[model samples]
Target: MLRRSGLQALQALLELARHGQQWSSVSAIATAQELPAPMLEQLLLQLRRAELVESRRGRQGGYRLSRAPEAIPVAEVLDAVGAPLQLSEGPAEGSDGRAETQVLQSMGQRLQNAIERELKQLTLQELLFDLESWKEYLSNEGGLMLG
Candidate 1:
């Protein structure tokens, strides 16, 4: 689903940049991630507007991360791509609904608070490092070494 496409795209771009990848078009990212061209294009536009990515305008032109991955956070990318996640009002005002709604309303607020707290704590640098470590581990279970 496109639900996580924006976040996924950001991760893909960060991974490619971390690997010294170079290509002249969105096709490169789309091909590498197996993402559709139109989808990648749409996300890329949002990224550009947020200044999270920049593109070159020539034969060797392609999109690239605009700043250090460490400087960006997953939450920021999500915000740039879509609306801020909000909690919903619970059930209608019948007796049972009111009873259930009261509890759900409190829980919803708590859930949103927790999510924002954690998201604020996460940094793109940490995410990228974790990703690199995972890929290395998978590719060389016994030989991948970190300094």
Candidate 2:
């Protein structure tokens, strides 16, 4: 969550899937996203191991998604990159007085669930288009509903 690599991987994969259509060198992706090269390398390694992405070697060598963006759920990437939520095991003091802690834990779980739902359904193509559209809107109107 703090690292942002999980989301970054999703964006990278989706962008490559949508636009690359062939090979997308990591350097290009890193430059485009303005992400650190070393970090990108590490993330790409993790994605490769998770089978979410595959790489080619040589001049035309680069990386691409192993499966369709729609097929690769954001939840899957989150799991592959990091645990859903940083949930510690429930307290050992299982008692009625622990209701407050339980409530907090439940709330956390709910938040994680909501995030997972959004990520799982959001395809790479959709995200890319949304970003491009938002940029255009911001540039043109400078605000959502300019008066």
Candidate 3:
């Protein structure tokens, strides 16, 4: 699962994509996505540094996607927000140098790699489509029911 910042960044990006190449103010995005403006601004700064989004100054200035939605991968967005998917480091301390430990470590690394590969193939455009589908489904279902 994504951290709060990563989720917020994705939401903000989706909002921008929905608007096409038009620049969107931080406040506008925050309000639309229900994210905190201050934190969203910081996340946008990180994204700008990563070159995932571009920003402009002045009264009519704000931020917009640096590339088309299809060109920006979900992995790239997570990376830009400093939330790269990764498994926790090696086994716990004080563990004996056992073959089982090594096997588990290798498996963990392989799993992480597979996750990264899938994420790389998933772009913002795809996610946006999925998001819309989910919204429609939920609405048709009269929202989700929790036990």
Candidate 4:
């Protein structure tokens, strides 16, 4: 349930990680991921401010990861982009105070907590690894079917 900007930020970071310390222009990442360049540019600036990404200015200058991908957690990226992990807010004011409402609110809070915990544990490197594995699996399956 990530906002578009949050998803774009993750995609941009993954692209940077794939390049392995190489500088990547906004246009390059935008084109590769089919994202809007202007939006991506702003997201990178936010990431830079968050200290998750480093940028340089020059002919060969662009953006790169500020630290190793393994050090950057998915929750950190979402937070940097202002995307809250919680899907909904707590109970509304002036409620009937029924047991059902209380139960539902408690369950919702528990779910949000679990999601936050998982996102914190997931690193950018792990995301990249999963993406690579999925691609490889699809390619292998395609080849087998064709052969």
- lDDT leader: 4
Encode model 4's per-residue lDDT on 98-145: one tens digit a residue. Answer: 988888877887898999999999999999988787666688465222
lDDT of candidate 1 at residue 72, scale 0 to 100:
75
Off by over 4 Å in 3: 90-95, 140-147
lDDT of 2 by residue, 18-80 (tens): 655588888988887787778887888888999988999999988888877667776677677
Sort by lDDT, best first. Answer: 4, 3, 2, 1
Full-model lDDT, candidate 4: 0.90
Provide C-alpha RMSD values for all models, in order: 3.6, 3.8, 3.9, 3.4
Give the candidate number with the greatest TM-score.
Answer: 4
Backbone N/Cα/C clashes per model: 0, 0, 0, 0
Please give each candidate's TM-score.
Answer: 0.76, 0.74, 0.86, 0.91
Of candidate 3, the 10-residue stretch with the lowest lDDT total is 138-147
Name the candidate, 2 or 4, with the larger TM-score value: 4
Clashing pairs in 4: none
- Model 3 residue 97 lDDT score: 81
